[model samples]
Target: MTNVLVCIKRVPETSGQILLSQDGQSIDARHVGYTLSAHDECAVEQAIQIARSTDGEATVLTVGNDDSLEQIRNALAVGCTAAVLVEADTENFGPADVAAAIADAVRSRETDATTYDLILVGNDAADTGDFQVGVRLAYALGRPVLTGIGTVEVQDGTVVARGKGPEGTEVFELSLPAVIAVQEGGVEPRYPSIPGRMKAKRTPVDMVTASVSPVGNGRAALRLPPSQPSVVEVLGEGPAAATAVVDLLYKLGVAT
Candidate 1:
């Protein structure tokens, strides 16, 4: 019997209207209503695929506040067995600190002598898009990691992963109890059907680490930038405009 644990993050929905902080650091999550991140959604879909393929159990684990329960239900609606939430609400909680907290959580599981065959995570959260957590956690866990993987499968304690290399597509076969980060496209994300949603709503979610001590604390103040002048606009005759545009693009190193 193989058990799979997927670690996911609730991230902000990037509506075009939203902008980053003025200092060019941190997001204005004030507008960031939580949602499953794109790559993390792919992680959930991959979990479902593996769970179906092997007929095993897959559980979702996340870190956030009460606002994150909806996202957990979203995961359950897709077909995950259950969910666990770790509330590590802090501002100073850098990637390393988050990784440490996850390591502590994994150790708690280890205390029971319970071990998962595979652990899945998004390559990065959309908000920070740091592309760090998966790798960081893997490092903390002292496990091998396959990063930027688009397609992945687990079979008998091994991971068969597809990633893009400089030349083209690269495939990896790594031993299990390992970590794998899902790429943007990867597998198709699943939506909880009406029935699935109903079941998920009825399903109970366990909240562990209720008062997770945050490693990073404090929100960086945020403000929008003053509107900038238009970068591009079309005008004048079509034929000459096309030629001029092409010439300008080439000159600007935009096109050849």
Candidate 2:
């Protein structure tokens, strides 16, 4: 049977409101309450789908503190059979560090002859919109990786996946044991049933202290919110009235 591994992260709630630090470099997670990103939830669900259809074991892993354990338990509640945590003290770690930590855990499992046929992750963590960990992890593991997958399925000995970029959709058929990064809307994640939740609470999460490298290359500072538009100025009242609006848009380089 194939063993599938899914990677997930607990991130802030979905919002366009970017809380900046005093410096202009990164976000402020000070007041943020981490939750499972919607996109990643889909990734987890997709892994479950693959496992159910292919008759394999699906496991979810995350890197962070005990809060990450909470997130992994939720994934288990949905469908995953087990959870792994590379416990970190804080969320300040970068993708390189997270990747390294995860690589360590993966290598350890492999050393024990624990088998895994595939590994999966989200295209990007929603909170930071940083699409790096999955790719980096794949590179570290020296495995082929596919990113931005929209649809996925396993047929025979190969896994088929579809992805869309600026150009269009691209289909890929990958051999087993590949890494895949999935996007949202691919599959609706299921909520945990009461029995699943109970079982998840009982399942022991394999926790390992992460040897994550420190991050602070350049300190970031926060800034205040930009001024909001005070009032609306009516422009085009009708199609005939849009001539001037179109002219203004042309001047602003939005229209030719």
Error of 1 at 120 (Å): 0.8
Tell me the tens digit of each residue's lDDT in model 1 across 1-256. Answer: 5677888877767764676756755565676566778889998888888877887778888776677888888999999886877776734576766676677777787688767677889988776667788888888888999888999887877789998889999999999788889887778897679999998998888776733455563446555667799986664576767887787788899896
Worst 10 residues of 1 by lDDT: 210-219
Assess each prediction's global lDDT (C-alpha) against the native.
0.79, 0.81
Model 2 local distance difference test score: 0.81
- Which candidate number has the best TM-score? 1
User: What does candidate 2's lDDT look like per residue over 1-256, in tens digits?
Assistant: 6678999988866454557656565566667656787778888999898888888888899987876777988999988998888787553576777778888889888889876778889889876667888888889898889988978888776889998867777889988778888998767789899999999898888987766676632334446677787897777677887888888899899986
Q: Number of clashes in model 1?
A: 7
Quickly count the clashes in candidate 2: 6
